[model samples]
Target: MSVSATHAAGPPAGGPPPSGRRNYARSYWLFAAPAAVVVAAVMVFPWLFTLYMSVHDWKVSGATPFVGLANYAKMLSDDRFLWAIIRTLIFTAGAVIAPVILGVWAAVTFAGNFLGRGIARTVFVLPMMATPVAISLVWTMMFHPQLGVLNYLLSLVGLPPFGWVYDTTTVIPTLVMVETWQWTPLVMLIVLGGIASLPQDPYEAAVLDGATPWQRFWHITLPLAWPFVVVAAAIRMIDALKTFDTIYVITLGGPGTASETLNILLYQTAFAYYDLGYGSAMVVVFFVIILVITLLMLGYRQKGIVT
Candidate 1:
């Protein structure tokens, strides 16, 4: 038969020849459709609603009036919101930096065949397994200037007892310290996985060249481990940016808004203040900040550096 005649006619005896691509495409929708539907239901719908709320003036009990960006404009002149953004940046930086540094150190330490390495690994990651609420409560008690064990330790060393989460001057730093302690183990676990997967050939070669321990880490290890470190850092940044339970439980965002990050402020605005429209705007802005951060981190990650 000619090409046009054969094409117009149906398949031969049984059926048309099977196609791998067509079969795979069919299977893809079969699996992905449910997940896509779920994402739209949970993530997309909420975001769309939040966007809707953001452009109107709606309190908990009031006639919802469409205000056309007035709520967003208010954010420009809102000092508390501006301060929340600044404090959020501070909290994110402090929370990410301490965990990453300490985690990398812990991972490197555990990578060695030292005594108690296995036990140390287990002990180290235990904090990550505990509930954040429980962790916050424990830290809150420990931060008490006179009654806490931490202050008592200072007295033994002839140092003055310090107010941790209670004092305005130290509240943010203290919360960061608590967060760093609780979350560093997570970073350590991630970095340890990366370290465990690293090739030994480079280290062996470095040793053959009479390289010192520090040199091996600085040259061979660090370059190979940079990607893993970035992954850990990104995860920590997102977690820190959305932190609320710890600050809420410990200080409730102050000794006068000293520890009020965006998350806490958003919570207080939406529920406590009952300004749903303005709160919705804050939510959108908060989300945009996180999205921008995620994009910047991912974009920088795409730019291949070191190794």
Candidate 2:
């Protein structure tokens, strides 16, 4: 009886089965806990607080009260806010366009084997490496009406000396120039990376077809590098939209508020006027605008990938 029925119940084959998915899930949560907590504390909490504050009337000198879209209504009707939006769009466009065209050209030039290419790249990127405040200060000195180097150079060239930031008409354009100087290196680096990574097959084929260098670039290089161009443009656009430090240091959104972008207006509302509720509303609007732009960029990237 013992022999027949006492065949020892062996353990299940393959040692023990693998741990269940639930166990791995628990392990993942354990690993992610610190990051999740930090994100909740730093980002999610502040965003939620801002949203709550936006729906109320909160002043720096007084208690907050529920205002239920009043701040939004006020912002919508404020002519200055509308102007800020327009200026933001114009500034973004200028900042994105000039830097992209110039940077791509520079990148293409550098991609060629040339003497002193390293030195040239370093010089081009110096503006980007410098602190924005320092750069702005230098620009301010150069833009000085009487003793500035820029006007001095203009005088030498038989052109009239101009007040760059002080003139209402030229303030925004001057800021755009500063921004392009500081940020163009970024676009150049991106484009250079893309160009360097390109397969040589297409270029070789074009050469075999008797295509000139310019024709090869126009037909093969540009299309292949188009994705990187779009990406660089989007990054520049977003940075330009949020530009504050250089603008603040240079013009203070002045020359009669001609250069006040959305960020400047939001700063004025929150810090200058101490209207937290209104400021929060402005921030929310700006956030929505940025989100829409980012989504559009992502859509373009997806299209690039698919095609």
What's every prediction's RMSD, in angstroms? 3.8, 3.8
> What is candidate 1's lDDT per residue for 1-307, written digit by digit as tens?
7999987785687875558667988999999999999999999999999999999898899699999899999999999999999999998999999999999999889889988888878988898989999999898788887789999999999999897888888999888998898999999888888888999999999899999999999898777887888889999999999999989999999889998989999899999999989999999999999999988987676675623
Off by over 4 Å in 2: 1-21
lDDT of each: 0.90, 0.91
Candidate 2 residue lDDT tens string, 195-282: 9999999987888899998898788888899999999999998889889999988888998899898999899989999999999999
In terms of lDDT, the poorest run of 10 residues in model 1 is 298-307
Error of 1 at 221 (Å): 0.4
lDDT of 1 at 98: 99
Any residue pairs clashing in model 2, and if so which? none
Question: Against the true structure, whose lDDT is highest?
Answer: 2
Leading candidate by TM-score: 2
